[model samples]
Target chain A: MNEFLEQFLVEARELVEQATADLLALEREPDDRASLDGSFRAFHTLKGGAGIVDFAAMAHAMHAAEDVLSTVRKGDRPVTPDMIGECLTCLDQVVQWLDAIEDSGELPGEADAEADLLAARFAARAAASEGAKANSPVLGTAPSSATALAVLQEQIALLAVRGEGLEGRIASAGRLAANIFRHLGRFDDAERIAGSVSESLAGLDTTSIARSIESALERLADKLSPSQIAPVAVRPDPLSRTLRINAERVEALVSLTGELTVANNAIGHIAMLAQEGDNPLAAGIADEHRKLDRLIAGLQRAVLELRVLPMRGVFQRFSRLVREMSESLTKPVRLTIEGEDTHADKAIIEMLSDPLLHVVRNAMDHGVETCAERASAGKPAIATIHLRARREGEHVVVEVEDDGRGIDPNRIRKTVVERNLAAADAVAGMSDEALVDLIFMPGLSTATDVTDLSGRGVGMDAVRASVERLGGRVQLETRLGSGSTVRFLLPFSVMMTEVMTVEAGGQLFGIPLDAVVETVRIPREEIRSVGHAHAFVLRNRTIPLLGLGQTLGWAKVESDSDATVVVASTGGLLGGLEVDKLGSRMDVMLKPLEGILSGIPEIAGTTVLGDGGVLLVLDVKELLR
Target chain B: MALTILVVDDSKLARMAVAKVLGGLCPDWTRVEAANADEALAAMHEKTPDLAVLDFNMPGRDGLDVAAQIRGLRPSMPMAVISANHQKEIVDRAHALGAVFLSKPLTEPALRDFLAGAVRQIEAGAA
Candidate 1:
């Protein structure tokens, strides 16, 4: 039961995210059946998950939304901007409930009341949509009598306009009056009305007949109901739409696969030992072990693939925040998302959410100017903020760029000095790049005045912290007049990484393969030293080399005539770490350093090599800095 | 052998909820779980459950469709459709299929009632 609750919470949050995204997407293409189905499915899943956990109030609230979505799916109601807003509100309520549940393992005291209020609102909206129902529209409990009377009124109007088609028009009008009277249980009145119309027809008097029909129509109008009864479209798509599984299960699968890969590597080592003896049976075992290694590697890859998820959910959320922020700031800003289909580890994407949101919000609030200000600056009234994510080798680079007033480095420098963030003389000598980096320093804001939109002092500092937590770094680029772009380069997955094992000082250290450009042998004869920093020329570019043994606090080892350098780069900072040996490359699932070593700058994580040796994966960027 | 019950819902949580009630009411009963209609039908194929609890609003096939399939083969099987939908149409359909329509959240009282109904049906079937 506990496991189920845990799983439910995970699935519920995902569905809420999905539903919110689909509703916002529907704002773009209201006629999109796919989004409609997607929304309905999400609500359905949310309600179902809630039900399983016996969270009746939450389930009931989602049911109301699901019903509204059902009506939209069946075309009984048109998808309006208001409806989308309502759906988003409903999702917001779900988010609140999920948060409360996560905190207390149960709902808040007012959950039922809140659920009822939201359900009532959704139901009221559903009823309003029914008012605009296409067929058999009724004014209010307005009986079939009202419909007949409406028809009679139309017929009489036609006759009055044509002035000559009175015979057919009067005959149809008389028939409607009779049926309405009969429906009202007034048989005598029906006959009397019919007789009066016929008598007027005999006198060939159109005016008299039309007058009687009008009086009868008035009587029927009093009984009208204020709604229409329209048939819902039958969407009989009986197929398995989607399946939600516990993410923990997938995580477990990945862990097992990692273990198998290590085990397989050990098997290879054993097989090599057997083949060294040159016995026929041992060689056969070695050949079979080779085939097993390939299979295990494939299985490992397949398992890890389960953790990859598209960035659509995370990216879609920004548009909503952008919309709300722009309206509140009265800034006419537009957001464009590119490469939303790019995929990354679910954990990486999760950690990226708030940081991404902060960047986007900061872009709209600070980077983009108001219409009046933009117009004066000769820029378009509506500013554009573009968010793009694309795979770059083993990393996913997400950039939020805006066409607003760029961050002024001069102001940042001034603020740095005024706020005493740094010594005045030191800040004055700082480069523009270094000054810009000061914005991310917590407790400081470059904004001159505090506004609700931003300027809360918690600026890029939080974003940088989050990105760094995910084994990623933040890059900021700004021009004085043009705009500012904040880019985050993160690994494809934070859970597992491929590292190149290198031996230094008789200890093994792993370097993320993505950060290593190449390994080269630079002769010591060409090495130069400037103020205790080692430098060497490699392919026309001067690269600095730091021996791993020297960096890790071991006795400084002097390089021989030819030295091995593992060239590494992070966030554009490059350096070479000379190690004694470069070992075999393998995949290792990482656990963040804990206990006393949690915040160690040099050690990113620790992993066990196949031979039971613990290897510390070096934080290449940190080491270079 | 203990009577087997198949619980189908898109939510693992909801499936667990029903399993809890079933476990409480019929301690000896076996409970099989499926996350969607396809798995539900697949479970039915393996071994017909004496009782089936389904949730509506799945992606592909919903509760009603799954119920209809079961109605064809196990016409006397006592089933309950647990959904968040409170529409009259859903209740009517459940009645037509001789199944009980239970609103979602599937709270303690609701599940207890469902169990009672299932237990009665199970005894009648055995007789």
Candidate 2:
């Protein structure tokens, strides 16, 4: 993933968690002010986030939810449990779609059904409210010069509650409203309110309201004039959201990253050839290499960072998620989230939305204890789920922890044994930690009954696998009586890494810096070919030598050159990449090739050299498989 | 009345899509198609259109050149330019040439809304 996308994944995961918890809480207490405020804030924050990240679909949906919340907050309407339920369902769909987008660049086919249902419900609610107001004027009708005095009185009364700073402006609005009423020949009512209008207007903040009243009076006077034979049409305001950028600019960035690599390699070669003795020329070359390396690294970082987007883009769906999930589960779990300003690769964030939701739902349905249970357990009646994120060295660590009935190891152990995953005898020898780890095993579940939330069978293993695929690791740690914490450690960015240069099938390839554990040059006599797979016993460990050419469907040939075996680790498994040469570590941008060219399993992407030659960056994780 | 319209484009798909949307919205309009500025001018002499929707970029004569020429010939004629890319430079140029700007890929609602606004402005100005 790119920097923007990577940051987005980390941030989006947190937002999803918050949204789910809030939704669950809102279900329990629909009229709770804090719950309502939090749900609205989550939606608003998610909408703003989605807008910046160009997640238009999520932004559009969140915007609709925001409209509902804004209307509710303005005291114009009430949020019902059913409405919250629908919103949470929408959230689930969006989360699933987001996950789909993360794993695959597009949403799955079923996302449209959820979007349509939510949109229709949103539209129906808006329409119903609009129809009610249209049928009943209630305390207010559309403001006109004839009703301006009443409008002024209402404003003055409202503003008076807030105190005196805006009194002067409010008084002016009252006067303007009276004038408009007089112009419209409603002088009888106008004259009655004219006495107190000035004092009332003075006690309000009516700058814009006063101006609008004045404009209305002017228009009314014009309309009443006998000389006005034809109606004059007012022009419409210009509104647009379109921009243009040069296509060449993006291509230029790609070329610059390539040039940096060439210059970097040349500097290294010059430094290596310097005199044996400590000389000024030799030191100068070394110094130049260091400076050039930093310069290139900075340039690469700057270019890659362009793709970084804030996590808020994906978080917007969470607000609706919270609204939906809270009602569905018949539980109240208020989500408190922070650190949304975190940025990451847009692609990574887009993919992160779903996995985050699964984790959240899993927490709410299975992790967080019920309100009565929590109170009986000497904890607060409501569960508090916290999601916190921050950068650690070259990776971003995102943790989702809830204060609830912690993971029950015995429950998981029984489930695993009943499912025939492990022998009953073996369960005794296994530690509590080992028993708890079973929750993440594929097709494992501890829920006694299957419901809409959790218990349907898919568990934490899917999330763990997806996180690992993004060059990250997922670890689960829980206290038996406390709560469970799932921490994901992912690289800050994926485009640029310190890769070890290796030659395979006589072609140069790069192994990711994190994947390579060690590189050893073993004598050819020690290498033995076993059933088409090359194996070498390094020290005591038997490692299989994965042929880069044979595995990738490239032309295979026998070579006389000494082999350099690079040991790499992928998904807790060790493998070796046998190559003819081992070059020094070099930094290069990972550029995914166009279309089907990138479909090659062994190749992660392609990078360009200063000389314009393409270097295939090998996917060490994929290669090991 | 059969309202005459000038359609400018370089991309075949974009032109077809825009035409289809226009046809769907205002089926009475008579469309005059042009691949570039040179073709647009040749078609312009054959008949003067009531309105023109020009594409900003093309190999021979870009949308801006054609819009400028239309402005010189008939300043009051309703003219709008469609652009795919979002660049202030091109938008400013279109504005300077006295044309409404619409960015693609043009959905049905977007196209209809732009046309409605443009038509109202044109008819209001004429009145």
Candidate 3:
């Protein structure tokens, strides 16, 4: 796309989002003038953006919405649910058109029909409100100048009062008169008012200030006609200090940084080889390698920082969704988002959108009860779904919690048995906690009838899969009658993985350092065999042991007099993996297994080693399972 | 002779918009841009400009506050205070500081009028 169109798309999308938020806020608080003005300005700017892009249809639609908003701003029409809905619908159409333009890099050819339909709907709403306004004797009939004059007169009366704060009142009245005159384009009258007010203030003469303001008010009443004092046209706020960089460009930079890290690793390896030789230059080469490593690390950190973005972009869309769902389901729902400014990798944020959609849809469809049902059950009629994101150590934790009907373990248990996902006797013995976990099993939905919204028997499982694909885990916590919170614990960033390379049975493997607790060596006599598996004791705790070579189906080599074990922890379980040697730690960009290697339970992914060899990174949880 | 104009706004986009308009109106006029009150004050200290345009709504000190300080330094300097918020208080403050109030998004004709008035003020002060 040309730069101008691209800029327009970015700006127009932001305006749409802003307008949607403001309209929703207005729906919640009809008297919120800030939201009213914000919506008006957003639509006005959106229309400007459309005009710049030469998209007349979008401009026409936006102009209609702006006109209705203008009426609301003027207090001629009160904000109604129907009006907010129409404005939201208009925004929805604009979003669709924006999507089309982004995809095709040009204005959509067939947008006129949709725009015309939306514009007509908005115009009808405006006209209907105007008709009602016309019938009312108190509204839309008084001239705005009369209101300004009334305000000035009130100020004059206050100034005339000989109160303790009389001086303050005089100053305020003087300011009011000056503003009134300036707004009327009578600059000289405004200057005269200002001059008199300042001179009076210097002399502490409140009467003179009031007299000057009264005369200015009289002049304004005579000269300022109704047509002269037009309503102030709301404009956009100051632009934020942000740059719109293409996501692909950042991804490309990440890839290049990863390549540089690999190259630096190769240099370190060469330095090691040189150190092994008896040459004077070996020390110099090693020094250069250390310097290069530091530079590469800084570069990697900067590149990763570039990919970090706040969670607001993903969280802001849920407000509109909840509103629409509340309307359709006949349930009053409120969505509260917290910690949306928590930063996470852009890739993680993008991948979270679909899974979050599924979870939120499920929350609305199956979790929240109808308003009538809620009121009868001694709960508030309005259901609140709280979407929160926060940084916890090296993880970005997202939670979608709803105050509604919690997931019933009994329902899940029955569904599990009916779906044949688990044996009846086994499910009967399972605890309620375990039974609730069965919801994550595919095709184990408890809803009797499938709804178009969420209960398609494919939501929770997909949510788990998507989160796990990012090396994250999904957890659910619920009470029988309270509510359910679906928590996703995800890695802060997926671009790089830090692993400790270990030599096992003459072959090398990579273990994610996050799971590495501690390594120890124990005498062969101290190890015991139990049920054909070896076990060992470390720090007075018994940890099961697995030979990496045997697990990979390679020929097992006899251990030396002492066994070297790498202790790894995953999913609250600790296991010692027997290795021949512990290698150095390094950062690598993990590539997901492709083709036949994909879906391997024990192997998580592969990374390129300094020797140009592939290192299989283990999924410690799956490996121990 | 060409004259230099100082434009101060917290938003880079707002500064660019003002600069673009000024460039079109007075191609020979040099423009100096500042993002905040401190930068604007510093620019004035370095070299005073013939005309100034300041955004009323900024981060630290508002445009009128800065205008008041400029008025202390050069009492007769012609200035315009620009803001999207057309509140009466802001306009009154701008007028008290001897600056014209211009609503945003600023139009070509409105800016042209302000510049013409400013030029006449500078000429009158020189005479």
Candidate 3 chain A worst ten-residue window by lDDT: A226-235
- lDDT string, candidate 2, A336-365, tens digits: 555555667655666677778888788888
Candidates by DockQ, descending order? 1, 3, 2
DockQ of each: 0.48, 0.02, 0.09
Clashing pairs in 3: none
* Cα lDDT tens digits for candidate 1, B19-119: 77767777898888888888999899897788888887677888989999999989899998877667799999988998899887677688778778787
- What are the lDDT scores of the predictions, listed in order? 0.75, 0.65, 0.78
Q: Which runs of model 2 end up more than 4 angstroms from their true locations?
A: A1-290, A409-440, A455-459, A521-564, A593-597, A610-612, B1-127
- Whose lDDT is greatest here? 3
For candidate 2, the per-residue lDDT at A22 reads 74
Give the chain A TM-score for each candidate: 0.61, 0.54, 0.65
| DockQ-based CAPRI category assigned to the predicted complex of candidate 2 | incorrect
DockQ of 3: 0.09
For candidate 1, give the docking quality class from DockQ.
acceptable
| Clash count of each predicted structure | 12, 41, 0
Report the CA-based lDDT of candidate 1 relative to the real structure: 0.75
Chain B TM-score in each of the candidates:
0.90, 0.88, 0.97
